[model samples]
Target: MKQFIQGIKDGGAIGIGYLSVSFTFGLAAVSSGLQWWEALLVSMMNLTSAGQFAGITIMAAAGTYIEMALSQFVINLRYALMSISLSQKVDKDFRAGRKMLLGFAVTDEIFAVAMSREGEVSSQYFAGLAVLPYLGWTGGTLAGAVCGNILPKTVTDALGLAIYGMFIAIIVPAMKKDSRILKITLLAVAFSFIVYYLPGLRNISSGFAVIICAVAASAIGAVCFPMEEEQEGA
Candidate 1:
């Protein structure tokens, strides 16, 4: 019980950061012709920042259902990978039903926090960590949908920086710990720029570009940094 409470406290701190960005998501939804409740429902179900943004953008642009579905499929495929990694950290006694319920809460931020745990993670602790952020994300979207029009354009522009900041926060520590991550980061940036400029690839859909980048990067990483026998055991 104590550990569970601690997880909620930890999650609440992280949730505060999400509030600002979700506000923009809400605003965009309303501006893009979605009802506030629909916007809120999207946030609640997805619980992912980039995926939701891409999905809404495609929807607003009158993209085909196939395009929207494919975009989300590509963007969110990372979560599937993250879940596989996290499976090793869960308590051995955790039931299938519990895992299914908790699986839906696996966002990048939550996975990062959970992976950093020092030992096997209890379901209670995981659930506690999920609660506040889940609520904050849902509530923040609603708030933004309702109040977006009143916010200054400059403030909204500045709020865009938050996503970049969040990415940096996630990347810096990993880069500091592993030269492989640094190398991969550089490679990804170079590859992205190349794709952005090269005429054939530049015109491709963003969803396809993301799939290419992820697969190429992961392949390179696997070749360069194959897991050791000991790591396989863990």
Candidate 2:
């Protein structure tokens, strides 16, 4: 119980951050043609900001289901790796079912918090850790969706710019710390521009363009800048 309480307290900040990000997502989703309830449903189901944004973009572009699937699979591949890493940190008695349930809530922030702990993470602790962020994400999305419906078009459009700010905030710090990341970020940007502007490539759907840019840049980045032996061992 004590550990659970501690988890909730620790998760409070992540919850607040999620609220802000997801609120912008809600506005964008609705403004892009999704109904308010649909936007809320998206927040409830998908916790990843990047994945959600990509998915929404694909939907808005009237892309096919296969494109959506491929985009999501590529965009969210890191979570599978995160889940594998998190598995090693769980308590011995945490059964498969509990682990699976907890896996559903293992966002990047939650995984980081759990991994940084001194020892094994109890299921209760992980469950508590997930609670606030989930609620805040869903609640903020619903609020934003509702507000999108009621607010004037210009106001909603202006508020929608916040998501770009959020993405920049997330990326800039990491780029500053790692030259490899900076290169990869630049490469991805170049790929995106080429896909959007190059004569033949411009004909591709927006969704497939995203997939191509992400996969190509990441593949090149991985090949060119493999993790060091120590990091691989860790």
Candidate 3:
């Protein structure tokens, strides 16, 4: 119980950090003509900043459902990898159902904090840690949606760029540490478009194309930039 409380306290930072970015998501959703409840629902349910933004971007563009799914998969692939790493650090006794539920809380910040703990993490601690952050994210989105109605059109228009700003905020710091990420990301984006241009490839389903591009890019990255230093903790 104490650990749970402590986890919640730690999670306050994650919640606070999410406020501004999730707020931008809300604004973007409204700008794209979605209802406030829909924006809130997205934040409350999805909890993925990049994936949700990409999805809304596709919707605004009148893109097909396949396009939206593919774009989200490409943009959010890192989370799947994150969940894998986090699973190793979690309590071995955690039930399958518990692990699955906790998996939803494995945002970048939560994963970092949970992994930094001194020993195997308990479900209680994780629960405490996840709840506040989830609330903060959804609350921020609702606030932004409400603000969207009253804020000047010019200001709301500029907030549209806020979505990109969220992307930059997440990417820039990581890019500084590993230049390879930028290269791989660019490679993935470039190759992922093949299904649109090549006649034979154009016949491929968007989901398959997305899977191929992401898997190939990740494989090449794993081979080319083997993480010896990170693994060795050097």
Candidate 4:
């Protein structure tokens, strides 16, 4: 019980940082003409910054269903990779139903925290950790939708920086642990920016750009950093 409470507390601490960025998301949704309930629904269901952002953008513009589907598919595909990685960490006895239930909460931050655990984790702990962020995300969107343009532009601009700050927070610690990861991350970021800004590539949709960058980076990393096998001494 104590550990579960601690997990919830820790998750809430990280989730508070998300509120600032989610606030901006909410405001954007409202500005795009989404109703308060609609904005809240997106946050509650998606629970992903990138996917929600892309989905709302296409939605606001009344994009076709195919476009919206592709946008969401591209943005959320990382979760599939995360799931595969996490499967290796979970107890073999973990039930399929439970895993499926918990999978909905598998965000990048959540996955990082869960993976850091040394051994088999109680589902209770994972559930506790997920609850606060889930609420914070939905609550922040609701607040933003209700507040709407009431917030000054300067405040929104500052809030917009929160997502980048969160990414930095995740990366900095990992980079400290592994210089190799740092190098890879830097290379990937540089490549992504080049592709994003290049004359011909710049014309591609942001969703497609993300897919291309992720695949290229992962492929390059795998080839450059293959695992070594050790020989046994007789």
Candidate 5:
């Protein structure tokens, strides 16, 4: 019970951070022609800022279902990896079905908080970690969607970068601690730019472009920056 309480406390910061970013997403969605309720629904169902942004961009552009599905898949591939890593941190006796449900809420912030916990994590703790962020994200989206055009352009533009700020806060500290992480991060950036600007590739659909960049970057990291497992007793 103490641990579960701690989990909710830990998630407080994440919830606050998500509120602004997801609010921008709601505004963007409506600006892209989604009904206000539709924007809130997307936030509630998807709970992924990047994937939702890409999917909505495609929808606004009249992209196909294949494009939406594939784009979301490519963007959310990291969550799958995050979920697998989190499963290893959970208590052995935790129920499988419960863990599967927890996996649904495994955003980057939630995964980081859960993994940083001092001991084996309980499903209850994980649930506490996920709930507030879910409310903040969904509620913020509803607010933004309702206020879509009312917010000034400059304010919305600034809010749109909140997610990038959140990512930087996560990545910068990790990169400072590990050179390998820095290298992989730089490689992903360079690889993405190439995909975006390069000839022929520039013409690729958004979904395929994301898939190609993500897969290529990950493959490069796996081969060039593989982690060496620590020995049982160094």
Candidate 6:
């Protein structure tokens, strides 16, 4: 119980951060033709910002199921990697079922906090940690979706850019600390630009273009800056 409460306390900052980003997602989703409740539902079902954004974009474009599935698979591949790393940090008795449930809540911020803790993370503590952020994300979506029409177009447009700022905040510090990440990020950006502007290549759908750029960049990163065995195991 104490651990649960402590987990909640630790997650407070994450919850607050999620509120703003998810608010933007809410606006984007509704403006793309989803009902307010539909926007909220998306947040409830998926806690990932990048994946959710991609999914919403695909939906708005009337993209196919294969496009949706492939886009989500590529964009959210990090979560699987994160889950694997976190598996090493849990209590011994944190069985498969509990692990599966906990996996549903493993956002990047939550994984960072969990991995930084001094000892093994208990199921109760993890559950508590997930609570506030999930609620904040969903609640913020509801607020944005319901109120988006009431706000000025200028205000909503500004809010939509907040997601980009959040992504920059997540990557910039890491990029500064690690040249490998910096290089890979730049490579991905270049690939995206090529997809956006290059002749013939520009004909690729947005969803497939994202998949191609992500896969290409990641494959290059894996080959060029492969993690040593020790780092991989960590």
Reference-based TM-score, model 2: 0.92
What are the lDDT figures for the candidates, one per model?
0.79, 0.86, 0.82, 0.75, 0.80, 0.86
Candidate 3 ranges beyond 4 A from true positions? 185-220, 229-234
Give candidate 6's whole-model lDDT. 0.86
Candidate 1 lDDT tens digits, 108-172: 88888998999988888899999888988998999988875566767655655554565577677
Model 3 lDDT tens row, 1-234? 998999999999999989988888888899877889989998888898878887777777677787877777777777888788777887877678998888888788888899899999888899999988999899999998888877888988887888878878876776666678877766777888765798878876555576688788878988987776365211
Clashing pairs in 6: none
132, model 5: CA deviation in Å? 0.9
User: Which candidate tops TM-score?
Assistant: 2
- TM per candidate comes to 0.71, 0.92, 0.81, 0.69, 0.77, 0.87
Q: After superposition, how far is residue 70 of candidate 3 from its true place, in Å?
A: 2.5
Predicted structure 2: lDDT: 0.86
Off by over 4 Å in 1: 149-234
Q: Candidate 2 lDDT, tens digit per residue, 1-234? A: 998999999899999988988888888888777999999898888888889988888898899999999998998898898898888888887899998777889788988888888899998899899999999999999988887888898886786676667678888998888888889889998999988988988889888887888889979989998997355311
Worst 10 residues of 4 by lDDT: 225-234
Superposition error at 55 for model 5 (Å) = 1.7
Residue 75 displacement in candidate 3 (angstroms): 2.5
Task: Please give the lDDT score for candidate 3.
Answer: 0.82
lDDT for each residue of candidate 5 in 1-234, tens digit (9 for 90 to 100): 876787788889999998988887788887777899999899998898888887777887788788788888877988888888887889976788997677789898888889888888898889889888999999989988888767677765665565456557756897787777777777777877888898987878766766677677768877886756542110
Instruction: Supply candidate 4's per-residue lDDT for 147.
Output: 83
Give one digit per residue, the lDDT tens place, for model 4 in 1-234. 775786697688658866876887787777666788999998988889878877876775566687788778866877897889888877765578888898899998887788777786666777778888888888888888788757676765565555456567757788778666777778778878998888988876655565577667757876887544332110
User: Cα lDDT for residue 16, model 3?
Assistant: 94
